[model samples]
Target: MTFQNIFFNSQAAVVVFFVLSGFVLSPSFFNKSINVRELAGFYVRRFFRIVPLLAVVTALSFFYVKSAFSTWKVPFANSWFDGVLAHDVPLSASILVKCFVGMNSALVPQNWTIACELLVALILPFLVKACTGRLWLAVLTFIIATALSFIAADGGGKSLPVVYAVDFVVGILTFRILQSHDKRYSDVFFYAAVIGLVGARNMLEVLTGQVDLPFNDPLLSLVEAIFAAVIIYGLATKNHMSRLLSVRWLVWLGDISFGIYLVHFLVIVIVARLMTSFLLPYSLPTQTFLMLIPVLAVSLAAAYFAFRFIEIPFNDLGKSLQRRVRTALSRG
Candidate 1:
């Protein structure tokens, strides 16, 4: 309803990624004809795509964590900012293993999503098999997943992969719908979906009169994923907004978006420290505002480099290995 509301749902944006992941990765499994070798190749590509950058980022975060324990200091009075760097986590093998597996680390807190993604990726092929067997089964799968998510939350296991499994199911169902029916929605409908996506949580709050619902609530996440599905539908069907999104620069940014996600936290911490020393004369608000420019610049530059040197190379290696798998299977 308002301009600020359009940006209020950052958690919904993560849900959008989940839905998009389901959509993008669905085509391979939905044919209902994939063999083990093909599935193996699929797993290989996904593993290579996600893990290499994550490994590098985790290693970098470990260095930052060491520094934070020894020498890092908050320049300002923000509690959340201070808590992330100055903390009581010990340097232990268990924590390091957890970080590698997508548990939260102060340096790369976003890795949990990657862990969820990896889990979904492994089970997705089976999900495709189960959900596509019948129409009612697909709906039942979603219902059960939602129920389980709530159950998980009640048991204080909100971060478990089951909590987000429904989001991926929404995506898989989106693909099924698109495959079965082809309709071109009007521009108004596409724009409406965008509005629904960005304002999902706010709209839910208005409807329920429950402000500040828990962030990982399954019911709220389902609404966000459904809205995301509509937006993905609009784009996949090539609506007017899809044209805007397909601009060359925007496409290039999408290519490096993963890298940006991995490196931005590191940039933020480094810049915050430098800003404390150099811009100490300014108010905290002004320092934060001034910090954005360099953060954006350095993050973009670092992401681009990582994409060029790290991601692309690894992706190609995955593809090459996939080809070999296919070739070997054919011979056997």
Candidate 2:
């Protein structure tokens, strides 16, 4: 595999996540003052949306090290917190507390993103409230955050909260723009985002020897978030740029994306163990290719089950609660 192929990019996708979040939650911010019960219910549903799978994954982590990964000898390159694929995972009390609090990357590792999502979500309503009618406020906030994105922070599993929140802000801005502007301006942002992802990369490569900044810096993360925001705008506006995103298969994949994101690591570990037990003689590439099939299949299946049984019920409950609360308020 090529270096870029082997390289896992958590940054580029993060921007997409934040911008999508802003677009998704944008509608909720439309009401000038969200009712207390509805707001509470919204938070509750959001909690269920992410935390249930995260809890399951965190529980599995303890078992993961001892069972599936015990025989896989390779360790994480940088830190012990990354957790050795073997049974050497750090499972301290504080880390466990952090897991519930949405701050535990040491235990679940990829869950740092979960923490960021939660943080952004919790604060999003406030941003929306403060800036709904005040366009200048939103612009000022985005501008300030954009400047801060350059100041380097950990580009690893646990990124800085503020830096990550920049993407969240971008998403919020995209939503605000789309919501307010009926003109074709949403198309402009969408094209800007597409250019940021595709054209900018090529342009930079032409100028510089090799594309260096995309991999190394959170600065690039800020730029990528613009792409995410615009794409979200396009999709929301029903612009031509986002036509491909509405395809049934792709939309299905997006539905279970969170669960897939949370569970894929464990799935990879299990497949690695199976490969080790039965196919020790196979080369790395052969084993890797074999791992992909089971990993994708298993992750998709697990995500569907999680969505059906755990996510949907709780989400429905939240919606029901909000309706009841609103009805009672209206009657009074």
Identify the runs in model 1 with alpha carbons over 4 angstroms from their true place: 1-8, 68-70, 85-88, 104-107, 155-159, 326-332
lDDT at 116, model 1 = 83
Give the winner by lDDT: 1
* Candidate 2 residue-wise lDDT, 8-91, digit = tens: 445566667776776678678666576665576568767766777678777776666656445554332234423534475565
What is candidate 2's local distance difference test score? 0.67
Over 4 Å off, model 2: 1-8, 66-86, 148-159, 183-192, 198-216, 277-279, 321-332
RMSD of each: 2.4, 4.1
* Cα-based TM-score, every candidate: 0.91, 0.81
lDDT of 1 at 238: 89
Q: For model 2, state the Cα shift of residue 159 in Å.
A: 6.4
Residue pairs clashing in model 1 are none
Model 1 Cα lDDT, one tens digit per residue, 1-332: 34544665668878888888888888878866668788888888998898888888878777766664435565574777665544444757776787776665544778768878988788898777666668888889878878877777654433557888888888888888888886778888778877787877778888998877677777788888988888888888888889999999999999999999888877787788766677788987688789999999999998999999999999999999988887788788
